[model samples]
Target: MSTGPGADSAPAPTTHDSRSTPEKTPPPGTRAKSSMFSSLKVRNYRLFFAGQVVSNIGTWMQRIAQDWLVLSLTGSATAVGVTTALQFLPMLLFGLYGGVLVDRLPKRRTLLVTQTSMAVTGVALALLTLSGHVEVWHVYVAAFAVGLATVVDNPARQSFVSEMVGPDQLQNAVSLNSANFQSARLVGPAVAGLMITGVGTGWAFLFNGLSFVAPIAGLLLMRARELHVVQRAPRGKGQLREGLQYVAGRPDLIWPIVLVGFIGTFGFNFPVYLSAFADDVFHAGAGSYSLFNTLMAVGSLVGALLAARRGTARMRVLIAAAVAFGLVELVAAAAPSLWLFALLMAPIGMFGMTVNVTANTSIQMGTDPAMRGRVMALYMMVFLGGSPVGAPIAGWITDAYGVRAGLAVGGAVSAAAAVTIGLFLARVGGLRLSVGWRHGHPTVRFVPRERREELTAAA
Candidate 1:
């Protein structure tokens, strides 16, 4: 079943006649069957993709600057946690409302407003930091503003992809989006670190502020005539509750969200941990800290590319990736030297991106199209909103137990969550995990004992 981007609306499914299937293969040398990158065929998506790449770099720069600014001011791990919490707390509080707004409005216009707001906020932060009169309060205010914008921006941005590429290219577009983000992660912090060393955090903010121009321009330049507008529903009472109900009814949706919340809340509060490790454990400077993040992004970029190559998005892969990601984090926490820890970050990032891309792709593919905005919004809440709760806990742990212990605790919790969820899914799906060969390749498959018996009988 399909649905539009609001409550109480469903779309008719397009029919495919099995009897009409063609047996003939396509001619060779005719593009050799386009891969996932085919989404770039759309002019609007190309513009949007290009703009987001530039904007994401700036966003990452601001993130680094904000973390550094908070640490410099308070000199407390908990303070950095507080800042992170403030930045993401709004998503926890108002994300559902934000989803509703996205459904009710034209996404292109909404994004324009959000991008403008964020630019203003970045400029405000830059001015404060540059004047030498900025205080912790100013940073808090700016962070809150950014978070507020995110509450609206995230859902719109996510839902907008389908409108750009259409449902046929949704998975490819999503994977590419992950690639875009991780790519920015690779560049942004490294640039911010150099900027911080040469000028100050303020300039990073200014650069980020200027980066908004690319996206704003992209949004303005989008030929609305080219958009594949999803039919939208009129707003109504209990829309938020209705969205919640739709998600609650689908295990495919709920389980991934639950898993993401567990991992995000327990495992993904890296900003706090990275800062603590940099200052307390390694006694390193900001450049080394940025280097650590850049290495992780290297891993993440590879993971994204790998995900893009996959033929299908499967639940088993998501669960396995989550488990692997947790294990990598556990190992990373125990590294004895800064160089060792930095090296360990590669797999940690790779697996983290694996989980992120898999979960995101599965949720988007599985959700009802009408409710896509709300579902993705909830996904974002779990994926990002958990930061508010997790950051402070990680911060406090870093302060109380030392950075290594704090990181170790997070890793342990993440591993435990992955194991628990994997077990639950196996039981519910009546699946037993096994490694085997398929299509002349090594593969993993989950099968019920009865299904195995039936298959053998049929053979």
Candidate 2:
């Protein structure tokens, strides 16, 4: 996912590193606990989680501020998209390499470097903008710089959770991570909006720059003794190729990445969508733009909490959530009034978060820990990396046709991709779709193809 400014694809084997997997058991004397907050019990994860909550709010704030600043300067939606694209372009070019880099280094140290670099980018922007010397090109350069840092930060962070919480808490921890981000989303945009309106965008950037301090402190504070470190991938010439080949062999892993490519490329360019709607369609200005994001965060927070309650991430959930996400966006695109559009943003946020959390948790829980950094890099590359391609296209469409056309195109592509991938996976896995009402509610089920045939014959 882009890690907003928002937001994985893949089914993967439920395995650990080449070394023996954690036994789905708790450490030492602690009993297995599966609460939504189970992962927080670990002192390391609690610290990490707390720091991330602070950092994520700052992230979202900067995202909103950055986009608004571009729009204010250029008054061009395409320019805004250009800024977003620049921010994610490096992830497309170097994200997999970053995974290789993470597999070779100490994750804690790697994160500190990436975090510090990003802070510098934020601070530089703050300095330029606050001094009243900032320009569109400066924002572009800083956005690209941040993207360069994220190439390492993203994969390192994804694979680090296991060390902090172990296999037993991996799924819950990932869900809570999404939840924590959404909670931050709820605050970040509203705060940024106010800061941009009442003060200026520079303050938001400055606060974001400072927020990096929290994660660095948390990393320093963690006890090395308690970490459940996974074996690092051995340094070798073929390591990157090896990781790619490993994923190619695993259907559970590769298909999800493919599906996400389509969705992320077309479906998830909300910075473009929301901004165009707020500025062009609604003519409501920064406050309206912020409100749209806040409403979506409200839905996203609800979705993340729901995801945290579930013990497992199923393929069924990913497909359903994605389908719902696309459909809701379609509905939202057609909303006639600003209030109705804002009202519809909630479900769009909910289903979008579900698609994100379900895919991320499923990928993390199902992959080999040794291969995780690489696999997650691919997952994120597909998710955030697509912004480079999609953001501009969305911007162009909005510029040429309208905001509604851009959104509808994205929604249609997303929904179509979900259906296509869902069926292809079923055929590959020897399952068939079974749709019927089990009680009062409509339901969709996947069963063995033979069983599906038998039931059809009996019917």
Local accuracy of candidate 1 as per-residue lDDT tens digits, 325-353: 88888888888899999998888888888
* Candidate 1 positional error at 164, Å: 0.8
Model 1, residue 403: distance off in Å is 4.9
Give the per-residue lDDT digits (tens) of candidate 2, residues 1-459.
121110011222334344334225334234344676878889988989988988999999999999999999999988987898888788888999999988777787788899999888899999999999999999999999999999999999998988788777777888898889888877898799899999999999999999999988887777766777566666667778878988898776787778778888999898889988999999999889978988898898888877777656677778888888888889989999999999988898888888887788767766767778888999998888787788889989988999999999999899988988888888998998788777788977889989899989988
Candidate 2: which pairs clash? 1-7, 3-6, 11-252, 13-366
Name the lDDT value of residue 215 in candidate 2: 89
How far out, in Å, is residue 389 in model 2? 1.5
Worst 10 contiguous positions by lDDT, candidate 1: 16-25
* Model 2 TM: 0.83
Off by over 4 Å in 1: 1-36, 67-83, 125-136, 196-202, 272-288, 334-339, 395-408, 434-444, 448-450, 455-459
lDDT of 2: 0.83
Model 1 quality (TM-score): 0.82
Angstrom error at residue 93, model 2: 1.7
